[model samples]
Target chain A: MENLLDKKQSIIESALELVHANGFHGCPVSQVAKNAGVAAGTIYTYFENKEDLIVGIYDYVAEKITSYIAERDDDSLEFENRFFNYWRNFTEFYEQHPAIHGFYDQFLNSPFNSEKVQNRPNMWHEWAHMFFQSGMDEGAIRATNPVILSILVNTNITSTVRIKKNFKTKLAKTNVNLDEISQLIWAGIKTA
Target chain B: MENLLDKKQSIIESALELVHANGFHGCPVSQVAKNAGVAAGTIYTYFENKEDLIVGIYDYVAEKITSYIAERDDDSLEFENRFFNYWRNFTEFYEQHPAIHGFYDQFLNSPFNSEKVQNRPNMWHEWAHMFFQSGMDEGAIRATNPVILSILVNTNITSTVRIKKNFKTKLAKTNVNLDEISQLIWAGIKTA
Candidate 1:
């Protein structure tokens, strides 16, 4: 059973590669199976269909990221410090695995946008929301709606990922530091 | 030449219909042409290829939206009133066109994010930046970085669009009125 789960996950990650490279509509399942070093039947065994495969990748990654963040002792640190570390770790992790960025944006714009995929108990949404609310209560972060604040932070990080992955290094040449991107957000939302 | 331009635009509009209906990559030039009531060869005369056709539609739609906001007279109104009118008008305009929304999110998320979009002197960007700066000057909005404020507005507007279109009516059931969303954003930036 464990081996079957591993094989299924491997196939899904491989599908992410093809999906991001070509596009949601451009990639084929046969190639995804080939890339995963699995058979097409194995792909079907894991996912009911291509749509399920696409959203499954998102859920899988979201769960992993949230779990990682939740395990951290962020409460020991200052609010900004905790958020900074989380943002750095989150962005770096996704940057290393560019395919995840592809799926994240894809899920947002896809029909899955309409699908309510058990997001509440999910580590990503719930934990992040609490973290921001904690910051707000501690007077470290602005008293703006923490939910909206969290949303802003997520958009900044992910949109930067989207922008950086999409364009050439033109912004870098113009001294557009990516770190400042977060700091700018942090500054705007800070209670100083 | 005038007749050709009208026919070409109609073809592109038809392409938008097909692309929106069947995701971008799912639709082909031949299908677009057939839907447009034009010959496949005629499409090639107007567009270089599928990517080009997609790009053309985006440029057309983006420019139209920007121009609508641009042609408005907000100069005489007070800042708050002006901002509200612009926000209301922008949302109304955006809500009217699902194709534009589809094309936009797909375009933003795709590797086509930059595409040297000839950015239409986006009044919205300029307005927000100025709003931040002027508010700080007048001792109204906070002393934070205007750039981040711009991002907050973006997060608010885009997420609102994302939810409004994607999330069905459940979002409103929670009591996050558009007016309150606007106020939450305004309060975040406003001076105490």
Candidate 2:
């Protein structure tokens, strides 16, 4: 069972790399299987079809990020500290797995990401909603829809990573200040 | 000359729709020509190749957006008013031309948006940089990188549009509050 799981993961990773390099249509299931060093039939054993595999990749990355942040979350910390901590972990995760950015951008824009798929329960979004809601309840953040706040925070993190990735060399000279970004977001959401 | 210009514009519009519906690779030059009611050879007359055509689309959309905002921009207004006006124009543009969002998301993630391409002069970014820098100079906003400010503002706008587009039916019932978003952004960038 462990071996089977490992193979499934390997296929997802391979597909992710391919999709990142080439858009979804550019990468075929057969190519993904070849890249993963598995038989074409093996891919079907794991995923019902290409769409299923794409969603699997989404779940894989989403779980990886949410779990990483959830594990390090300190509920005892004040709302501001907790916000910055979440920002740091989120930025670090993306920095380490830059390929996920491309995959996500492509996935979000693709037809494969239908309204049905988006409405499905997403771990990261759920965590964000809970965190923001807690902040509002504690009167740490402004009184508004938690979903809006979550969107603000999540988009900030993703956009920061994207800018950093796109202008890596230019930014190396004058470092992309993560603290400034965190502060800006904190200011945006905090009670004013 | 006017007829020739219209033909070029029509080709670009058709290509944008095709690329938005189908990812870049899925839409070939031949299909674009057919959709535009022009011969395959005619597309080559205006654009050197598929890549050139893609860049042309970027320039076309970028100009369309920048000019729209520029025409309505009242430089005499206070910075806050100007900022909100810019936000309103930006949001309206996206609302009217939702196809641009999918095309941009795909283009940015694809190799089509290389560093070389990104470095090319963009009217929209140039306008944004100047606006933010002026805000900082007048002490209307925080003293930090204008690029950072622009990224925050731009990302917020794009993310808001994306969320609204993805959750149109749901958002219609809830009404994604533009005022709330603008206020959040204003609080983030304004001088304390």
Clashing pairs in 2: none
lDDT of 1 by residue, B1-192 (tens): 359988888887887777666666557878887878888999889888777888788778766766676567365555666566656766677788777766766675665544454354655456566755775776765576565555556555666666566545544353234445565556555665
- The lDDT values for all models are 0.69, 0.81
Which residues of candidate 1, in runs, are more than 4 Å off? A116-121, A136-148, A164-168, A187-192, B1-7, B17-22, B25-49, B69-93, B96-98, B111-157, B163-168, B173-192
lDDT of 1 by residue, A1-192 (tens): 269878988887887787677667656888888889888888888889987887788778888778766676369888889988888877877788888777776766655544466443566777787888899888997566555566667877887665566444433342234565677666667775
Question: By DockQ thresholds, what CAPRI class is model 1?
Answer: incorrect
What's each prediction's TM-score? 0.71, 0.87
Can you write out model 2's per-residue Cα lDDT over A32-144, one digit (the tens) per residue? 98989898998999889888999999999889989999998999988888999999998898889877877876676677777688789999889888988898888898776
Give interface RMSD, per candidate: 6.0, 3.4
Candidate RMSDs in Å, in order, are 5.7, 2.9
